[model samples]
Target: MRHALILLSISATSLFLMSATPLQSQTEDAQSIRMNQVGYFPNGPKRAIFSSIHKSDTQKHFRLIDATGKKEVFRGILTKPEYWKSADEWAAIADFSQFTQAGLYVIEVQGGVLSAPFQIHNHIYEYALNASVRTFYYQRASISLDANHAGPFSRKAGHLNKSIPYHKDLGKAQNARTASPGGWYDAGDFGKYIVNAGVTTSLLLMTHERFGSIFPDGSLNLPESGNGTSDLLDEIRYELEWFKTMQDADGGVFFKVTPLKFAGKVMPADDPSLQHMIGKSTSSTLNFAAVMAYAARLYGDVDQSFAQQCLQQAEAAWQWALKNTSIRYTQGTKSSNYKDVQTGGYGDQHFEDEFLWAKTALFLATKDSKYSISIDDLPEKYSAPTWAQVSALALYSIILNEESFAKKVSEKAKVMVQQASVKILKEVMAHPYRINQMNYIWGSNIVPLNAILTLSFANHIEAHPVYLTTSVELMDYTFGKNPTGYSFVTGFGTKSPLHPHHRIMMADGIEPPIPGFLVGGPNRGRQDANSLKRYGGYPSQAPAKSYRDHTASYASNEVAINWNASLVIALSFLEHQRALSIHEPK
Candidate 1:
């Protein structure tokens, strides 16, 4: 037992010596002092440490501590790309080495009357060889030690330019100038007109319900004019009034019209040469009325009597369309009306079937059984109709409160929605040169059609993967790329500009105008001296090409409006579905 005690004592002494050795060595080692520390703004022209400390609620403060124990602080601000060009600056600081403890240090910042603190820590390298490799690697990448020779560290600096002065006097001059009004403008640019009106009305209605305001100025700003909320509403009101003026005594709208002149023209009626054209058929007339029904509802609160009159006119238009179904003419083997020749037989007819969309909208407004019958009869004509046509039928079914019918159509539509992803891919491959513009056969039309179809099928069927994918692609293509700029130059080539009248006109005081008035000249075959010069003295002078030049000839204004409106509606529905999904029982 005595021998065991002696061995235990020796072991205890050795353990105590080992434990106390590090503590004694830590105090005896020469202390590394920090010196000549500096700080500056990020990317700034100058490099100076004006103060020892800086502070801000939103900004992060950085510091460099030297071997002599002196420290400098840096104040930085974050900014976006647009702001970076005009505002923010950068700064470089001296080396820091004295604060190399393996623990966090809280450094205080003095902001005149305020103060703040930030914590920083020192990292140790377990493998010096790896550390040397990392240092060499960074050096090879054009990053190395500064004048202080303490660090080869890289940091991203985000700062706002506080030095640049702001001026309010130049605000008026800074406003974007309006383009010249000439060349081809929308005579009856129906699609865009309707789509704009529909989106405007829907947004106004939705916002009014939430905020008790007729227009939400904070949210809706005009892209071109940069107009405020009130200005947008006034613009919408002006357009509605213009549309009202274009209404015929029979309650039907003309196929096309010039909004500025308030002159209405029925294509075949006004131009005898176009009487044989398939686009001039009465089905287009019915579609116009259907659009009018929704417009009437939107403007109803403002003019109830006029709104009621529009609904009645829509009913009459539907009746007229049904009666004129048999009026057939010839454009080659393809019948001008009644029969489907494009897809062979009427098994997948959608050309004139689009008229059913108006029928559905009108039925929703009036709840007429005839509209319901017209919609139900669609399946009898086509063995398996397209999602676009069936979606329209489903919408009508929903209006009739026929849940079963809606479910049936919605199921079919859901499958088509899945097909949309593959369909879009095919569309891209089919038209490689101008996938966004020239390939109207399946490009622009399919996108919006798919959106509306998906919306119709939303609750009745499972959400289609293509619904989300195609919608995003369409929005990106339309609002981001195509509409802004990327349109085809028509009239100069064999292909006539799609609905030449719908393009916004811009005058350059040049003659022998180009197709789109917004970017080129009048393009009405009138050659002037200025136009010749603008065309670079080419033997055949033509106008410049812009994306806004393309228009849907079938019903330009209505189609555009409907497409955009459908997008708005679909988005709203999707949001509502998401909310429901979140709140649903787990």
Candidate 2:
């Protein structure tokens, strides 16, 4: 039955691919061609091509043509379709065996009934296959989709040689020469990718027994250390050094700061987003710091002084948060604390970022009697029962004073985990895309998944089968199997729809343009202009755009920093788990 469903899906995808129209052609017949290859260069002309449906009996042919019909770039024998799937959708493969560079392309069947043009931006492929390969072990490890078609961890217990190459390639491509000193291009507001890269690397490093490595100088590729016991002391050491380079003097890592602008304004020092650090009650920071600390311990031989310094910095940050309690958000003056300020100010208030994660970090860092008291006496200001906050609190309780806090947190974690399990399972059963804010299944969904892992580790609750099932499912959707790469865009207003394309026809009024180099966008051409009309008008009332644009400035940094921090932590957790599994008693 499963095989039949898969076959059916493939057929439907093929039909869909063959039926859509290409962007350049207006007539149905001309448009029916599917794009075989598409490529985009940073500052070069877009390129595209179409596959010929009717192959000559004597000749297998491939053709590349420009929009003007004046140029036929190159052609070769058509190759087999490259099959790949995203979270919810199956894509029919068009062969791109002939082309090498990036640009737009198209493919068509004989009837002219099926055609589509895709904008091929190889940056994603390059990042995943090139840059990541250099630094980490990728070839040995393979992400697995479990029975439920969800991802829990990379599968295959093997030597390092196989896995490290794949990851190193991906890292290298992702960090391919761009405008940032960090090597990787920042995803701007979607800076989670940066965290993802770091986390992925750390995990690979932690499990070095399963993934081999090539030294930075590329002098030699080493074999697996044999067994999982070859202490990842060196890998941990490197990670610590890498992390230090990521930090700022004030002890905060700006989510991303590059593409240097004239004002030298990247991420400002006082952005509320920086508050997501754990010592500051931001769940995101806490989670990352906790993972880092955990990694430090597991790897051992880490620079203890450096580790202590980081811990101290974290402590100071938390102290600052506690001391600066008066800087709460003013939602018409009803706010009591920063939590209230965040919930009232942000839409989808339930979505967890760094703030909620920090609570757990604080508890872990201090373990002091007063901190425990604060945890118990957490005021109504932090009363919101969002899953993120609940998860962080649950983890914090278990980590700080496990015996005392476990009973309550365990009960709560169980309830929340059950709820999320039901919600996610039902959605996946119905169809992956059936869930609202489909994107959330990838980005926001990670929070609940991490919470489940934390809760399980804390013994707050028995291992909930559903929690694992759902988490695996979400992971599979985003990073397992044939993962779909998300193209992120910046410059949207705070009120802008989460999906970039959705905001194209803004009904809201125009707002002041965001200050800086607007990265990728739907209206990539019009980002520099001051007025909405120049950018094909606002999605809503012109005034609403202005209002949203202006208001966006206040929360942008917080959103970026918090999300990035959270991602790093989540990745760290995964890496830690992998490391532990290496030495787990069989």
Candidate 3:
């Protein structure tokens, strides 16, 4: 454990840089300190990075000051100023990992420089997991969010969808309607897309599966609090039950349920618009199949009938996908005469990933050799999972289980994960902030969470102290230890997003954005500048610094179900790890 801690510290000499497109900057504005604003576990690794544009402003020492006590608790000499000038002007670590007192404190340098205050309690991350999980309940459609459940964010039920009509593109009359009701609003808007739901539900289910002990019955205080199931599963079942409605008679799944255009800042209850059953695609069917098959395995003992139904539906969807092998979702625009907008689409021409995922899940659920794919077909590159690509998720499931596949296939899966970890570890060491992904894209925050989720899975495949510490360090980057210095999630941390690009929070008259939501962080793409009229510009063009906490900055600020699912998984996994190791020293 001590060796793992040493390797993770910023004191490590060798550093690497992946392919990154840095936004060239010469303006003098880089004097800041960064650390996890949400706080840290008492026994876990603690680190802070300080940056300055004044290449000459060399402060040799740093101090840890208690915010409440207003006294120096510890002090240490800063590392030699190195040229980490790509993202940071000057950088060094204030690693007070040994000062394990439970209190509120900040890292200080040069007498006045201080980082955001953070707590040092054992249960520092408890509310993060609970609040993130509860946000799903808040995202539920058709159910009124009463004061008892939603607190100040309460609202009248909206998008009940008692009659959802098929869109003109669905080979039906424009007026046909179906009673497909009640799931999550997929992202910032009210529409719920099956493709998005598939990944979101899968990750949430995986979280509950591995960390089931953390979320007990009635833990979340949902309406289904005492219903003999964990509140986490109860919330997930709401999505699963809705998944039952999206399936066609022939076992196919609809791509999405959304309006043609977006509603302009209208509250859910007041937004009078129609949602249509959008086109169906191969990707959606396969995603549904994979999630359902995976879920069936987990829920068998708790809900036998539902589990059986899920497995049957999963097989049927897989068959439908096989028959209609090439359909893609080139459907309606989220553009707004009709209203409620959903999230993005799956890949237009790639169903290979989908096939691999669906096949793997079915193989696991049924233990049937026929559902297995060949080891030769395994993806050469294991990228971080997105809605469009989930082969990595399939590989993770395979690697997590002991001898779940043919020897060659299982060995290949483990190698792929292990290879990815080595690459990720290099990125973690090379980046000044110790982040894995340096080139920011849309929903950039999801990359690290997914990567850490991958690392957590890697640890299960082959136990390594480095994997655990890598997960913890990258998790630190998520909470606020990076260049952005924002917790990236709403309602946690000393500094967090106040205005995310979410319609509910925008129209609900709430002063703060919805709690537990993780915004699309620091997208250098700046797609919002073109999409919104008179857009609020991004703070910087740098890949890691190009974020704005404005409701109009959808490129960087929109909250999504998939992103929330990843955050919940990463945070809860660490929380589970903390519980395991805290007792070792106590």
Against the true structure, what is every candidate's RMSD? 27.1, 18.0, 8.0
What is residue 223's positional error in candidate 3, in angstroms?
Answer: 1.0
Q: Write the per-residue lDDT of candidate 1 for residues 1-586, one digit (tens) a residue.
A: 2222322433342243223222212211111111101111111111111122222223433343221233333333311111111102121122122232322121222232111111122111111111211111111111222312212122111111112111111122343221111111122321112212332343323222222242234322222123433323333443444444333444433332212112233221122111101122243445445555665655566567867876766666666656655332222244433232121121222335546556656755666665553324343332112322433432433432444344555444344444443455455323211122232231143344344334334433445433433332332222112211221222111112333332221111222222211112112232233433443432222221111232222222112232322333343333333322111111
What overall lDDT, based on C-alpha atoms, would model 1 receive against the true structure? 0.30
Q: Tell me the whole-model lDDT of each prediction, alpha carbons only.
A: 0.30, 0.30, 0.77
Candidate 2 per-residue lDDT, tens place, 166-185, comes to: 11211235422312111222
Residue 527 in model 3: lDDT: 78
Q: For this target, which candidate reaches the highest TM-score against the unseen true structure?
A: 3
Clashes of 3: 5
TM-score versus the correct structure, for each prediction: 0.38, 0.38, 0.90
Candidate 1 accuracy as TM-score:
0.38
Worst 10 residues of 2 by lDDT: 158-167
lDDT of 3: 0.77
lDDT of 1 at 305: 84
Off by over 4 Å in 2: 1-301, 328-359, 362-370, 373-405, 430-432, 436-586
Of candidates 3 and 2, the better by TM-score: 3
